[model samples]
Target: MIYVTGERVQAYQVRSAFFDTRWRGLDPAQVHDYLCRVADEMDRLHRELTTARTESERVRQALRQWQSRHNGCRRRGHDD
Candidate 1:
C-alpha cells in the first residue's frame, strides 16, 4: 500500500490541467507550447534536486567515515 503525499498530489493536479482540452480552450497549439515550457522547467528543477540530494548524501557519508576513523584512532590512544 503506497501513500501519496499532499505535495505530490497537488503537483499532479497542476500538471493535469495543462492536458485537459476543456480547460485548455481553442488555442491548442499555444497550450501545447506552454505545457512544453512547463515540462522543461519541471525537468530542470528535478535535475537540480537530484544534484542537491546526491551532494547531501556524499557529505553525510564523508562525515560518518571521518567520525569512525577518529573514534578508531582515539581508541588506540593516538592522542595528538
Candidate 2:
C-alpha cells in the first residue's frame, strides 16, 4: 500500500503494535478496530489527494493556453 502521509504509517503501526504486558495493555481487538477505521479514513484522503492533483494539472494546462494566446495577441498589438 502506498502511504502518502505519516498518518498512514502510524495506522499500520498501531495495528501491528505490541504492548509489554505487566498486567495487560490495551485490548488488541479494540486496537485493531481503531486501526481499521484509520485505514478507511486514509483511503478517503488518498482519493481526495488524487482528485486535487488531477484538478491542479488541468488548471495549469488551461493557464498555459491562456498565456500563449495572450502573448500572441500582445505581439500583434491587439488589445482584445
Candidate 3:
C-alpha cells in the first residue's frame, strides 16, 4: 500500500503507479491523467531549478574575478 507523498512523487513514480481496482475506487483514467500532469510540472520545476543554480554559479565566479582584480589595483595604487 504505497502512498503518494510529496517527496515520493517523482516523474517516474507518478508514471508507474498502479492502483488496484475496487468496487468504490476512483477512476483510473482520471488518476493517471492527473498524475501525468503532476509529473510534467515536477519536470518543469526541476529544469528551472537546475538553470537557476548554474546561473548563480556563473555570477559568483564573475564576482570573485572582479574582486580579485579590484584588490590587485588597490595594492598597486598604495605602492606609489
Candidate 4:
C-alpha cells in the first residue's frame, strides 16, 4: 500500500521512476522522458505561483486605496 501526500507526490513519482530505471537498467529514452515530464511539471507550478502572487498584490493595493478613501471621508465629516 502506497500513501501519497500532495506536496511530495511529484518528487516521489520522479524518484520512483529513477529507482525503477536503476533496477532494470533502463535505456536513455525512458530517462529522458521522465526528466521532460518533471521539467514540465516544474514550469506549470512556477506559472501558478507567479499568477497567485500577482493577484494577491493587486488585491492588497486595492484594499489600501479603499482604506485611504474611507479615512478621508471620515475626516471630512468631522470638519463639518
Which candidate has the highest lDDT of all? 3
| Winning model by TM-score | 3
**Model 2 alpha-carbon miss at residue 74, Å:** 2.1
lDDT of 4 by residue, 1-80 (tens): 25566654454345455434466586878776777788678768978988999999999999998887787777678531
Weakest lDDT window of 10 consecutive positions for candidate 1: 7-16
lDDT of 4: 0.70
Q: Residues 27-77, candidate 1, lDDT per residue (tens digit)?
A: 877766676677667777878988999999999999998888788778788
Tens digits of per-residue lDDT for model 3 on 1-80? 37756655567777788888999999999999998998899899888989999999999999998887787777678532
The per-model lDDT (C-alpha) reads: 0.69, 0.74, 0.84, 0.70
lDDT of 3 at 5: 65
Q: TM-scores for all candidates? A: 0.59, 0.70, 0.77, 0.57
**Candidate 1 Cα errors over 4 Å, as ranges:** 1-26, 72-80
The predicted structure with the larger TM-score, 1 or 4, is 1
Tell me how candidate 1 scores on lDDT.
0.69
Point out where model 3 deviates above 4 Å.
Answer: 1-9, 76-80
